[model samples]
Target: MSAEIILKANHISKNFGLTHALKDISIQIERGEIIGLIGENGSGKSTFSSIISGVYPATSGTLELKGQPYKPSDTMDAQRCGISMVAQEMGTLPGIGVADNIFLGREEKFTKYGIVNRKEMYQEAAKAMEVVGVAGINPADPISRYSLEERKLIEVVRALYSEPEIFIVDETTTALSQKGRDIIYKILRRLQEQDKSVLFISHDLEELMTVCSKLIILRDGVFIEELEQKDFEEERIKELMVGRKLTGDYYRSDYDGNFGEEVVLKAENVHIKQVLEGVSLELHKGEILGIGGLTDCGMHELGRVLFGIEKPVYGEAVLGNGEVIHSPKQAIKNKIGYVSKNRDQEALILSASIMDNMVLPSLSKISSAGLIFKGAEKKFTARQVDGLSIKCREITQDVKDLSGGNKQKVVFGKWLANESEIFILDCPTRGIDIGVKAFMYQLMYQLKKENKSIIMISEELPELIGMSDRIMILRKGRVQKIFERSPKLSESVIIKEMV
Candidate 1:
């Protein structure tokens, strides 16, 4: 608590048009401390982070760095002042090698007379990779060759190579697996030991409580409270973040009733290449069935197969009333919704408006007798926007400009409008705030109440334990064990089965 204050934000405020994004917020970041910036979706956290990281200039405020007034004009300016940020959406250049991406703009260090010094670049890249706990990635290899988790590591490495004194991490852990997160923690601990400052942002309260010494709460562009480590509680933090006390567990399901006589979805001996070997599963009405294992354990392949995204060599999925779907188009026509693990790639149409995206799934429904009903479409879109609590000035606004949580809600809304009987959600709440996560869980419970069966595929053990009425653990594409909810599953037990 006696640590030196490295950065101070005094009465910071910003506005977009007539809307206030930040309303007179003040906070101090101390050296060697891990501080968490907590808030709901669109609750000024991103705006505040952007202000500090030089993505935007504060309308009225003063930012002091080590007791000296600092105003950064751009990201490069912020970096020059010893401040750097690594945002959640991994922004590594796909076509370039790791070394090239690391020293992207500042290639002069690895250049001589306009010629790149490839040898020096590789050495620096290797050192940066090691510092960030990524050693297996080859400096010469293109970034496109890496996975999402691997690209996440590259972003961290890029920042480390820039030599930042105050590191701003914005929800970086949501993309990472538990093991990948552990590696990040190690790097943060090392930075803390060296008396460097870190502002950690994440939706996982448990992880934040374990790491952050101080927590700042935000609500609707207003600074609500700042709590010490002693005051940290899961319910308390969540309530503060959303300005309300949430009911039920982190995941909600009513386990008292049967799964129903009607089969909403049936995967009959589905196989995709050699990864899936005659895998079959049945999901009934009003059920939340979870599937989990390692990333490469064939769990993902199963979702793709069921959704008709993957071309199966053998077997098929049958909808309610015995309608077979051989492709995604057929599945869509059958009224089945799928949310992929890769939100950026598979789920969202980034360039389209939130309204356009939301109404996409139900275009046919809105079209009447070969005539498009625009008014009816707007009515449907409005209902979805309000139901999901999607934050945007208008449905006409591009989804690309919205926060990570809002983008996900748009994807959900797009599917929900179609009146889909079955839902397949793969890591639906990844890379978002806790308040948004709670909302996602609440939405799922609401859907369950409507007799909509869901298949949740996730790599997170706690999420599976929290939400699923029934859980299936797969190992090497084989169903190892299935656990029912009444038994009250534990993380350790599930993890043991997974390994």
Candidate 2:
């Protein structure tokens, strides 16, 4: 017997002002199947998913849910019709309790005579979180108390609470660590076992291959091709998505791990409460120092402490010039830059224009006698935008409107324009596509050649091996080992130290 079709999207097209976000596209989701959506940034992967989830109405198209005409006015309407989505961006709201975020719009169920039953809602919310294997999150606590990864899992709980037949995950896994990813994987498998459907959107091709049974490819808002599990090939999928064969090295070609003897940035016996304990490291000029560990292994905290975002309880991070770093403002003034792992919240001002964000770090350089120059600002912003190939209508466009890759470019461009000598990049390439990842790696290589220093903190072991001159493995608020860069450095060796 043939499998039942759960949802059908026909001749879908979407537009925003003069820009065509998605062209004519048609796809279907089948019961008991996992479908992967693959494409580069701004390729309409999220747009299509948004149309189905009722976040945006299609400019033209028709949708059939279980062979019935489905027109959802909003996300809640879609949820009522057994459709749910976990957005790529942060979806939970601050200044609210975890239980309130879980049952955002559907709080009517817990309403008794116009008074919300807080006790009953918290119980249900706790149960929902438990179902997703997320522990230690109190439903009564404010959502702001949790980290980005935990909040992502909370969004998962919210989506799963609806028990929708069609579950859409839009680049949500990129923000999660291995433990969090395993929880999502388990949820997807359980949904498949129950004869439900999933639409998995991701930039990680290897991850898609592992979790999805079939893959749909899109390029420049057009449907290019689709592939089954048996026909899946990395190069072929990349070609189909980008419309060209990717050439050149994906990472640094040389195995030589030589770096300057001069220490540019040093963390001297730094400690951050429970996060980092006696973490000491040296970032030399013209070096890419990769720090790797599990999600809560304290490497990220080390990065923040080094960048002066978090103060160490005991030791300090100092520069070769004997400048003591005490705050972010002082660090920036001393030619140090930081790219946060939580890009949206910490790196870029989403509401501001690209020009504003790009010129923020260089405002003093472009200003004279307490006066700002629009000409200088435009010139600076224009140079970075063109050099980085940041796709946008204009520099005046809002940063939030750009794709994830372009947003990251803006973050990089700001620091580059400021001429920062030392960079602390945390998860720099997260949620971006392969093409962009390659570009970022090349950029780092160029920075190294210019004698700039870098401290790259990441959760991915392969990236740590691929880019760093030396790899430092942290486990439970302590450095387990530091391995020099060599051709024979394998993930297995690094994993041993990290665990």
Candidate 3:
């Protein structure tokens, strides 16, 4: 039986001045089939999608939709062609409710005499939620009250409401819970029934395997292989994405951790009201401590509080080695580094140049005798950039212009340049490509080799299990379980404690 082709991208390539983002990428997505786009960070999945959806026009290529030549000059044009992309980043107004966000531009359709038909919109939203199998969220409640995952769901519902013939979802599921992801799978199943196509992107290859029909692997901004389900293997996929056979699992020391004399971190009976309890934990030198649990578990709060971005009403974190970092500024001054899960929010200063961002943490460190030393600063950042292999045309490029993976590398550079001994990383590889993730893992390992301690907070059980030397599962602002080392680590083990 011949499959119906919904979209074809032929010889698609995009370049940002000297940096070639996409290279003659060609792909055929069949009608009603889910195509998985896989690549390492800066490998060009998003760029390809951007070119197809008119976020940016292709440098040179042809995009055919339903056997008709299609060139989306803008996002609105893409929408008109029944091709819509739900960006991983939420652009929702914090004051607006889910219903309004879902139907923002099309609110005029539900209006009567130029007045909003709120009740009708709510009813329609309820039906849409029902279709998408989401619950517990009030359409009337302000979007600000929602969790990161809930906001992501709202974004999904918003994009899906347009009934796009071809839907592009980029790295969205990491924010959603198991139940929420199931809802998305159900929605995609429904879309499949309607003969709609989807370009599904995620770092979770295992999850993609369950949902996508074929996996198109990209490397160095080029399409390398289109792997059929029959040929799908985790090791093979990882190898293809990284362009090398991985050595082991790319985690820290697999053996039981050998505790050092110095204390790296200490939090004493910290309280954050309803969100976080009187939590206390101590970290040692050269250790990678893992944190995980359900979405409501106080792990995120704990990270924030320890970092001093969120103040605690009670308790204090005493650094084991006497580094006074009670406030965020103090924390930065004391050489503590942080990479947030919400990449766009806490980590990136999008409007700033890459070099500026890379030195943001170490600005004071780079200056000497009350003078800005450009040469020394450049030398410091250049070394880290080379070590991290930052994928940018130049350090002067805006951090916003870099891909998710490269942007993250810049965040790492900012911290690494500070020569921080203690690092806090939250979902560091969330939206990046496998290659970039591999590099991040290697970087983490390298940091450990440098005898630096790290605290890794994540929702993905695999990364936590595959990486951390110590595992701590937080449940309802309390430590449910803390495994001393990799001697006892598994997704099932962590999941058992996390919930």
Indicate the worst ten consecutive residues by lDDT in candidate 2.
457-466
Residue 358 lDDT, candidate 1, scale 0-100 = 83
lDDT of 2 by residue, 10-93 (tens): 999999888888999999888999999999999999999999999989999899999999989999999999999999889999
Lowest summed lDDT across 10 adjacent residues in model 1 is found at 249-258
Instruction: Give all candidates' CA lDDT scores.
Output: 0.85, 0.93, 0.82
Candidate with more favorable, higher lDDT: 2 or 3: 2
For 1-499, candidate 3 gives per-residue lDDT tens digits of: 9689988999998988888888898999898788899988778888888777779899898999999999998977888789888776665777778899888788987888989989989999988877777788888778899988888888888777778999998877877768778888888888888999889988888889999888999998899999888898999998898888878656555675665657788888888888778888887787788888887788887888778788888877767766645787888877789888887777888888888888878877778887878788678778888988887777778888877888888888888888898898987888776767878888887787678988898887877877777778888888788876665555777677776
Query: Candidate 3 — which pairs collide?
Result: 40-435, 41-433
Clash totals, every prediction: 0, 0, 2
Ranking by lDDT: 2, 1, 3
Model 2 spans with C-alpha error above 4 angstroms: none
RMSD of 2: 1.1
- lDDT tens string, model 1, 1-499? 4889999999999998877999999999999888898887788887898899899999998999999999999888898899988886667887889888888789988778999989889988898888778968999899899988888888888877777889988888888877788888998888899899899988777889999888999898899999999999888888898788876666655455346767788888876665777777888798888999887778888898888888778888778678877788888888889998888767878888887788877787888897877688788899999988888888888888788899999888888888887899998887777767878888887888888999999887877877787888888777778988754668888888888
